[model samples]
Target chain A: MTAALMDGTAVARRSLDDTRTRVSAYRETTGRTPRLATVLVGDDPASHTYVRMKVNRCRQVGIDSLRRDLPAESTTAQVVATVDELVADESVDGILVQHPMPGHIDERAVFDAISRGKDVDGVTANAFLDMANGHEETFASCTPAGIVALLDAYDVPLSGKHVVVIGRSSILGKPAALMLLGRDATVTICHSKTRGLAQFVSEADIVVAAVGRPELIRGEWIKPGAVVIDAGYNEGNVGDVAFGPAAERARLITPVPGGVGPMTIAMLLAQTVSAAEQRES
Target chain B: MTAALMDGTAVARRSLDDTRTRVSAYRETTGRTPRLATVLVGDDPASHTYVRMKVNRCRQVGIDSLRRDLPAESTTAQVVATVDELVADESVDGILVQHPMPGHIDERAVFDAISRGKDVDGVTANAFLDMANGHEETFASCTPAGIVALLDAYDVPLSGKHVVVIGRSSILGKPAALMLLGRDATVTICHSKTRGLAQFVSEADIVVAAVGRPELIRGEWIKPGAVVIDAGYNEGNVGDVAFGPAAERARLITPVPGGVGPMTIAMLLAQTVSAAEQRES
Candidate 1:
């Protein structure tokens, strides 16, 4: 492979190490562990796995995990009330509601209910706006932050780069574009409505694929020597970009399993520790 | 002059006519005129003209105008406090603080202080998030809304189009991208940090120039037959795009003076009426 591999696992491990030191210092000073409340709605196997991964990572990083698993039939009001209770709980420093909630539940309302200070997941509108406006408070969404960290670790400076982000969903595409803009990179977000997807990607110095469509971005569409960060973890562990051809052209490329996925949990842990520090302070 | 003029004045006039009817109905039902508070800090000649134009449009549309002129020495807290009072005032339907506040003032804090319900100018972070997320909200920024209205009037469908927005300012570029995304247009925001500005523009089906830098975007940069909306009204009335060359290539182009300027005030009035109606409802 001519393209240098952007190892998300290695970066995440470093981040976890840093977070561990911070957690230790925080615990020594405050005599308490930083706590994260994870709310999982429904029994989707993937969702359960993701939550378990996060909770286990939190334990390894010396943070407390409070898990709330709701049944599939949980009402919007019940979910919101549970989130609100977490918002008010003094013991919980951060709250994260795993994605793909039951079809009936109002996800926006639930995300909005989490206190902005304790919104470690950074899914709330407030956090999105804060990130968009260059005033990130408390936390940033893990995937977006991880993408930026990956770029930084690879020494891919975003300043003056044309960053074409393929997606507009709040969690990944939107926050990723905002973070890129914050770094002074000119960002363009392409979604389903985008007429010419390949054309935009072809011109990008940095391309971020978070659209969740497997291999939607063709390898030939990538600009020569551009840095490509694939945030897409699609079915069968695939990514948005067709890696085989893209890696041949890209100067630096992130692989599916070892790229964005690991960094996400790392950022979550870092933010959780930061939240704890804020509470203790 | 082969390029068809995007007559912002004519379009704005139509919008005002619609807004007038809406205002009449709102006044008839509410027994009160739609109130828009205009807060101007310092004596910027251009800012003065913009505010006067808006106030005049308010009178023409049968909406009430609340003008608050502060000195150049006004502190950030003072401006924020004034906005806070307006937010609390039930009589005020919308509050607009003219941009480019004195160098010392923290403008973001002042804008955020305006209650989201009364944020007709759509400067608040909360209002932006609301617009981006498709949540029903009070209003959008006048210029961005005007851009949408202009495109809609011209039968420009945003869905599935590559929209290259060349700016990242809160009121213009950022909000414009968000609004376009809300419309399902794949939006890419480019600014100083973008490496290949011309390449991005050339790939765009619709190019929106909101960057304040005069003639920053060259005519050759435009894609042939693209719809060009120049929101940039910079020094000496120059636009961000090189008008002459861009006009030759563009299928539709909005001129500097007669384009986005007039439409901005029109949308402000329209949203002001909507805010009033919302209050009454």
Candidate 2:
């Protein structure tokens, strides 16, 4: 049986539309548009493209974008200083420090430098603690938050469901598991070190493949009628799930390009507006 | 087949002996005793007993104890102010605000007020994040750290093992699961909202019962040869697991009173000395 598609593109569009309205209302009330400051480091083409797309989304939602681009040779202290300035700047409602900021630079130090209130990207340790503790107002990592939004948009049940998240990165798998657990779903976190991974996947009522490996989660491992959310976007647009075969078994499945990608930016935009509204309160 | 006991009492004695050595060495080098400042809000008998026990351990290990007892009528702001003093005071090497403060006081606010470096009890959000991210130098919640130390002392291999943690409280279950996952164990976190709890428990290689309810994890649900770590401390010395029946099938098990209790105090003393050493460095 062919599975129904979880149309994240449509969901993200609706989210951004809501964000646009909020932005308009915020501007009317405070006489200032919500602004998101982004830090882009090095010359990675993909990173540049991602920042540009985010800035473009800011414009579409009636928000202002402040871009701080740094060279490949920039030190951790410089990036942290830039973030410190944004944290002190009352005009910047949200801050996003694009990840993978050169190998030599400490990414965590810079992420921690972002103010908790302005941490729209939700990369800070303080932000993570808030989310882990089930604080509804706390910002979450974009991809994980987007996955939750997508699930909620489709009215998928999370409570008491066994969710096997196939990754354990702090930004993606770990936070996703914590968020799912917070929603009362029984959550299992598996990583490269996990033994008998296929057996774990087979038992999951909801399977979330966040490992970046292309088609790492075999389609045959999916339980029939399970809800599959593939947060992976590997090279060549391939996902971690063997999409075709898994779609045949899954009750609902999210497609690669249109699935998690759009929802991520939508959450980012939504969170930026939320931060602005918070300032007024 | 009867399961072997994990012997937390013996292990804790060894650990405390080591802490005493460290405390002496730290004192010799720094010309000051390692100090643990504990804030006990209200006069709850249990909390007072716990604080007195911890202070006793501090003296046993050659560390100094500073006690701050506040009235039951204390507001959240007052509790936070008390913590703030300890955070700013250089003489206090570690700070611990006993849990379950007066219902009126915001426990989290007081926990957050402690400086991260001095949060020896590991109740702060910053410390939780550090533990979640597997930072080696960061402090961890005492009870959870004690459980890990017990497992290590018993030579229980954690890598690739399926660990089912029953509970989601910030201090115990959640951090314990994160620490196990850091050690390469595939971790599943289940709580009150979880469905089919028995099935999940039966599949685990290691079962950790941190839920305070006595005998909530039934003996029949335990997998044969599985390691059982019960962290529950309930009335009449009963634990979350049905110990007598569980020991019949388990490979290794920890007793309720003698198991997790002593190890907790040992970890607190060790962390206090560690904090003192950090100051010396």
Candidate 3:
């Protein structure tokens, strides 16, 4: 491959290490560790695994985690009440809700209930607007924040570049585009209804494929010398981009398994500590 | 001019008439007039004029107006306190806050304070998320909402259409792009940093120019048979697009003085009555 692999796994590790140091220092000064309250509303095995990993990482980094597991049949009111309790909890520095809740429950209402002060996952509307409007004290949504952290760590300049983001999910694609726009990149958001999607992708200096469909963006669609971030992780460890062919055209490309995945937890922990700092001040 | 002119003045009048009917029906059934609270911070003459026009529009539509004009020296805390009072008042169905608050004031803080139920202007984070996510009930920001209303009124199809929106202001360009995306359009947001802005503009089926730079989008760059919405109202009645040349190429174009300008207040009133309808239900 002519392109260099963007080492997201290594970058996420360094970020976690820095966060560990900050957590240690914060605990030393404040006489308490930053705590994250994780609320899981369903028994989805994937969510269970993800939450366990996050909680374990928190423990390793000198942060405390409180796990709240609700049944799959739990009502929307029940989930919201649980989050509201966490919001009122003085000891909780942040709250993370494992998404894809039961379809019967109102997920958006629950996401809306997470307070801005404790929204480490950055799923709330308040946090989204703050980040989009370029407020200094904003907390970013985890995956989008991780994407940016990776881009910055790799010395990819955003200002004046053409960045095309494919997908429009609330937590990932939409917020990622907003955050990119805040940093001064010209951002275009394409979805299922878009005409000439390949032509739009080929013109981009950076392409962020967050659409969950596997290998939707072909190698020929990628602009040569472009930076590629495959934000999708479908079955069989595949990303939205055909990595082998895309890598040949891309100057820098992030692999699916090791890339955007690890950065989400890293950002969650870091933002949690940052939230604690803000609370202390 | 070969292009069909999209008349915003007539469209806004129709919208106001619809809102007027709703307000009158609401009053007849409930025995109380719907009310809108307009909060104007600082003594900027332009803001004073805009708010006056809005209150007058409210009067014309049989809605009562509560005007809170704070002095230029008002603190952010003070402004927020005023909004909180309005939020608690059951008689006030909607609240509108004039923009460009004094440099010393934290405008976002005040915006966050306005309750979602009464955020008629849709400046709050919660309202932005609702509209962006395609939720059923939403109060869109006035100008962005106005743009969509104009398009729908003129029977412009958004599905599978390529829409290039120039400018990325938090309340205008970005929100307009999101609203279009919610309607299943392929929306691209280009800003000052966008390279080859003309090239991007030329590829779209629908072009929304909101850059506020007069005549920045040249006529030759406009694709033939495209729908153009010139949202910029700069000095001397000029728009962002070179209107004369663009009009020759476009299938439909909104004029500067009578176009996207008048729809703002109309949307404000319509959403205010909408808030009242929800409250009564």
TM-score of each: 0.90, 0.97, 0.96
Off by over 4 Å in 2: none
> Candidate 3 falls in which docking quality class?
high
Higher-scoring candidate on TM-score, 1 or 2: 2
lDDT of 3 by residue, A154-182 (tens): 99999989999999999899999999998
lDDT (tens digit, per residue) of candidate 2 on A72-143: 999999999999999999899999998788999988789888877898889887789878989865689899
Candidate 1 lDDT, B166-213, residue by residue in tens: 988877888888888899888878887777788879978899998889
> Candidate 1's error at A177, in angstroms?
1.9
Lowest summed lDDT window (length 10), candidate 1 chain A: A129-138
lDDT of 3 by residue, B116-215 (tens): 8899999888888888888747689999999999999999999989899999888899889999999999888999888889889999899999989999
Q: Distance from true position, residue A189, model 3, in Å?
A: 0.7
TM-score, candidate 3, is 0.96
Report the first chain's TM-score for all candidates: 0.95, 0.97, 0.97
Q: Model 3: how far is A149 from its true place, Å?
A: 1.2
Each candidate's DockQ: 0.66, 0.84, 0.80
Determine the C-alpha RMSD for candidate 2 after optimal superposition of all C-alphas. 1.6
